[model samples]
Target: MKVTLERNHLLKSLGHVHRVVERRNTYPILANVLMSATGDGLDLRATDLDIEVTETVPAMTATPGTTTVPAHTLYEIVRKLSDGADVVLETDGNDQMLISSGRSRFHLACLNPDGFPDLKSGAFTHTFAIKVQTLKDLIERTQFAISNEETRYYLNGIFVHTVDGPDGVVMRAVATDGHRLARVEAEAPQGSAGMPGIIIPRKTVAEVLKLLDGVEDEVKVELSDTKIRFTLGGVILLSKLIEGSFPDYERVTPKNNDKALVVDRDSLARAVDRVSTIASERGGKAVKLALTPGQLELSVTNPDHGTANEELAVEFDLEGFEIGFNARYLLEIIAQIRTENATFMFNDAGSPTLVREDGETKALFVLMPMRV
Candidate 1:
């Protein structure tokens, strides 16, 4: 097998799919990327059995064939090559891959292409087109709240489905990590109505986001009961669906949190950032937000590293109240706020609280308060 591709083109293509390759692996072939030549380009593919990504890059095909070579090794070698230099790759009958650029050359051990798992492209029970920006916004608004705990596999993804929204039916995405929750709504794409919700695993969400990078064009989505495929421009991604149901997130969100406080998102972020500096050293690492009628005082005490405080003038049209929260969790949800001002609705210190943009109801965040 042989192919000739520019250094930059090789690097660009590898950047899209390398993240799917696991660093440590049980299968030898899983560590390598499968390279095969098409009519005028090379197709690079990498997978960890659960998720697979494939991309096409322009290359001069010397001989159309396939071989699997170590993903990171090839990426590192191509990355260090002189910019724009042409790279030549060739493999022997034994699967040893030879890569050459100018005076530099490398021979990396390769695994047989047959062992590289085949990505079974399944039929789409339902297919649809979605704007790139809409998908990006949904992910950014909810990804921060995705649970990282593997044991609670059901909560480790962003739940996406159609719901009867305030403005008729709308597509919504929800994510929660037990401590905090984020929900974003978008006008459901035509034909996406009535589509049942699906929980997109965190890894797939991240990879799909990376694939969407640099692409403003509409992406084609095909989904089945067991798998989902994302097609955008020249890249394609296939992922196995998480085989469990997500938690009842709707029931967990508070319907009416009476205490309302409106504050500038940037101001809240900065105050949280500053106070967390001291909280980072304390047990439970909590931050206390004491809200008065017109002032919001943020404070954190370490008991070992003293305390930090910041006061922000806010539109707190409520009685005196206080809430304790983990400093990291508060900062994460606040960072997702894109608007100038944010609004918080609190039931009490012991109940779940809701947050949203001051004037927008499209996105909502819920956080469970901590006992500091």
Candidate 2:
């Protein structure tokens, strides 16, 4: 195959697709990117066994054919070339690739394109179209809480499904790592009535978010029982759905906690960050929280090290209590809180505490209190 593609456009497409390729592979072709030159343009594709990404860019197709070349090596060569240079790629009879531009040249060992595992855009039974902003919001809101432990394979990705809520149909995304839980919901988009509740792998979620940055038009999505597909302008991504069942998250949310403590988000974040500096140097990453009549105090102490405490005036009522929590976790959840004031509801120091936006009911965070 022979083709001529603009250097920067090729680099951009490679940058987007190559992250999915594994560095060291048991299979030879999995390390390569599939380049297809048609009469109009060239298509670049890369995949691990679980996720696949494809991007099309304009190129002059001198000879129409398909071949596989090392994904990372090609990207590096093009990246180091002159800024506005054009890249010419051709394959020799012995399965080697020749890449040339200006004074630099490269010959990379090529693999048989037929050896790559099948990336089928299988017939999808359901398809829907939604605004790109809607999809981005859903991911950003709840992706932080996804579990990283490998034992509970089901909890590794966000649970995205439609459910019946008090108001009507709502689209929901939920994630939990056994210690903290984050749930977000919004009005369902136009044609997702019968869409299945699926667990999108964590890596796929990150990749999709990256792809959305360049696209302003609507995204067309298609899914089946085992796989899902996304189509944006001139690009497509396919991913395998996680196989296990997610735990029932509804039973975990607290029904009632009368103690309502409202604290400013920015102030709380700053205080927690400062106090945690002392606590983190010790162990357990635990910090103490005390809420009294007029002021709230954050303190952390380690017998071997030192201590830290900060006071802030907060809105609170009823009795006083003390609790401990992972300082980093609290800071992350607070960062996601967009409202001016965030409310914390606690039953006691030992039980799981509930956090919500000052007046919003649709999104809430549940955190298991830690012992310092």
Candidate 3:
């Protein structure tokens, strides 16, 4: 088999498919990308058992055939080649693939494409289309809270479902890691109502985000009980869903936290970052926030690294309270707020604190307090 394609087009297609291939794999085929050249174009596919990505790029096909070669190696080779150079690919019956561009040539061992595994996508129960930017917003607002702990496998992904909202039905994404929780909602898209609540694995969510960048077109999503598929432009991604049940996240969201404190989002985030600088590694990175009627004091103390203190005038008129929080978690949650003011609703120093953008109900964050 022989195919000739522009170097830029080959590099772009390889970039899209090679990321799914792990650097090390137990199976040789899993480490390689399956390339099928037809009269129309060249198809590239790569998988790591759980997730698969495929794309087709236009090329001049002299002979039609299929083979598999190392995904990363092919990407690197094309990436280093001179721009605007034409690339030529050929496969021989001796299980060898040749890559040539400009004056450079590479010989890559080829695996029979017949042995490549296909992620069987059975009949899908639900299908929907959503704007790329809207879908990106839903993932970015909550993905940071996904758990990494292996024991509670359910919390390792974003829980996506449709729920009733004040105005109407809205699609919601919730993620929690026990210490912090993020919940964000958007207007439900057509054909999304009554859809199954599925947990998208962390890796798939990350890949979706990367693929969505700078995309102006809509994304087509198809899903079943066990699998999910996403199609954008010429690229397709399919992955297995997490099978465990996500906990009832609504129960953990604080409902009656009435002590309201509004502070400049930028100022609070900077203050938390500054004070935490002196926090020792042995002692957890905790910053104490002491709120008064009109002022807020942020302080951090470490026996090994001394102490830090800062004050900011805030819009707090309720009863004063002191709360401790993980510095890293606080900054992450604050960064999600798009408004100028970040409103914190606190029940007490021990209970979880609810935070949101001023006058915004679409996004909310809950943070557990730490003892300082």
Clashes of 2: 0
Better of 1 and 3 by lDDT: 3
Error in Å for residue 280 of model 2 = 3.6
- Sort every candidate by lDDT, greatest first: 3, 1, 2
Model 3 lDDT, full chain set: 0.93
Give the per-residue lDDT digits (tens) of candidate 3, residues 35-147: 99998899999999899999999999999999999999899999999998999999987389999987899999998888999999899999999999889999999999999
lDDT of each prediction vs. the true structure?
A: 0.88, 0.88, 0.93
Give the candidate number with the greatest TM-score.
3
True-vs-predicted CA distance for residue 193, candidate 2, Å: 1.6
lDDT per residue as tens, model 2, 268-329:
99999998886764577898999898789999997767899999999986778899999888
Q: Give candidate 3 misplaced runs (Cα > 4 Å).
A: none
Which of the two candidates, 2 or 3, achieves a greater TM-score against the reference?
A: 3
Q: Pairs clashing in candidate 2?
A: none
Tens-digit lDDT track of model 1 for 214-293: 78869888888778888988888999887788788889888978888989999898889888887754366799999998
Model 2 spans with C-alpha error above 4 angstroms: none
